[model samples]
Target: MKFLFDIFPVILFFLTFKLYDIFIATAVAIVAAIAQIGWLWLRKQQIEKMMWINLAIIVVLGGATLLAQDETFIKWKPTVLYWLIASVLLVSSLVFRKNLIKLMLEKQIVLPVAVWDKLNLSWTVFFLLMGAVNLYVAFSFSVDIWVTFKLFGATGMMLVFIILQVMVLGKHLKPMPERIQTVNEQDNLIEKIDNKAGKK
Candidate 1:
């Protein structure tokens, strides 16, 4: 499934880091990311812009870490990606008058514009906070601990955030009488979330 495909790299990186060193884990992650994209391309699917950005971070930051024989660059990777996404979401919402969360979920779950704005702002704030947390853990903890934070802590928080989002959205779900949309739209939302997961 798309979810599995999206998480394959992070899982691989975690396992690789456990069995080997950070450099080895970085190499494995980069290869896994590339393979994921290639597999999607072979299916004639369009890769999300964010997936390419993730790959870039892995290769560039991971490459720097490997080249300098230092883990600092790699440690900053998640924070960099997180802040970048948060910035984009905030800018798009405020400057361009675009609510990305609503853009992604509008067809699947109808809600008032004000509610969508709140959801978008919520995600923007979440990403900003997540970025700060990544940096705090990276600098305040050991390499091993940071790796665990990257894989488990970040993922756990994300899952919790998603659950809360669902709970909030429950009250805003459109009435059943308006369920004229196809299942494909719902599936697309899943795909969107899966692609978003590529940030890790």
Candidate 2:
């Protein structure tokens, strides 16, 4: 559900492009991006940093496409966004000495420090490659093909990458220890049992 929501604008853009043209699709994408943020704000949802980044990029590049009457701006949108994300991940880990991925997932899962670093680097590299791929498709293929690739090919690749990441991470995931009662907790439990028996 969340994944669909994240790609809402892309889906709308692809459909609009098929029904109309690139210009119309760009306008729809811009509107969709704005609407997405507005809806989240109205619902009092915590808007993620990445959502804001995406919205900003779409508005800027999409607006350029509309105002200048050129599809080039819109075509560059995905590449720019992907590179920005990759840069953030790389800079945060290397210069800031902080792993954003680890920070986000550490509460839910535990892994060795080395594993965390590798995971972060892997994502950084993947985004870089995705950005390059977007450029290749956008310039080498027709607009129709690029739009289709944007909607399906890019999404499919992302899913495949994530599945592979999960498979690799599974080997390193630490098994959760079984819960054990402390001595004090055991004493409390026994006292409660005795009290219940006395009442009976």
Candidate 3:
């Protein structure tokens, strides 16, 4: 559900492009992004920083597409956004010695420090490659094909990457301390009960 929500604008853009044209699609995408932020604001939800960044990028690039009557601006939007994310991930890890991925997921899953670094670096590289791939598709193909790739190809790649990451993480995740403590408590209680029953 959250994934669908996150990609709502892209889905709308693809459908609009099929029904209309690139210009109309770009407009719809811009409106959809604004509507997302508006809806969240109305609901008093804490809009994430990424959401705001996405909204800003769409408004600027999509607006340029509309104002200048050129689809190039909109086509570049994905690459720009992807590269920005990759830069953030790389800079945070290398310069500041902070692993943003670990900061986000450490509370939920525990892993060795080396694993955290590797995970962060992996995501950074993935986003960088994805940005380059978007550029390759956007310029190498027709607008229709680019739109299709934006909706399906890009999304499919991201899903596949996440599945691969999950497979890797599965091997390294450790049992939470709380879970271990609960299991130990249960075992001790069962052992005491068994000893009392044996004496009786």
Q: Which stretches of candidate 3 lie over 4 Å from their true place?
A: 186-200
Query: What ranking emerges by lDDT with the best candidate at the front?
Result: 3, 2, 1
lDDT tens string, model 1, 156-189?
9998999999998898878443454556678889
Q: Write the per-residue lDDT of candidate 2 for residues 61-156, one digit (tens) a residue.
A: 999999999999999999999999899999999899999999999877789999999999999999999999999999999999999999999999
Q: Per-residue error at 160 for model 1, in Å?
A: 0.4
Q: Candidate 2: list runs displaced more than 4 Å.
A: 176-200
Candidate 2 clash pair list = none
Q: Tell me how far the alpha carbon of residue 120 in candidate 2 is from the true structure, in angstroms, after superposition.
A: 0.5
Best by TM-score: 3
The model with the greatest lDDT is 3
**How does model 3 score by TM-score?**
0.93
In candidate 3, position 132 carries an lDDT of 96
Ranking by TM-score: 3, 2, 1
Provide TM-scores for the models.
Answer: 0.87, 0.89, 0.93
Error of 1 at 143 (Å): 0.9
Alpha carbon RMSD to native, model 1: 11.8
The per-model lDDT (C-alpha) reads 0.90, 0.93, 0.95
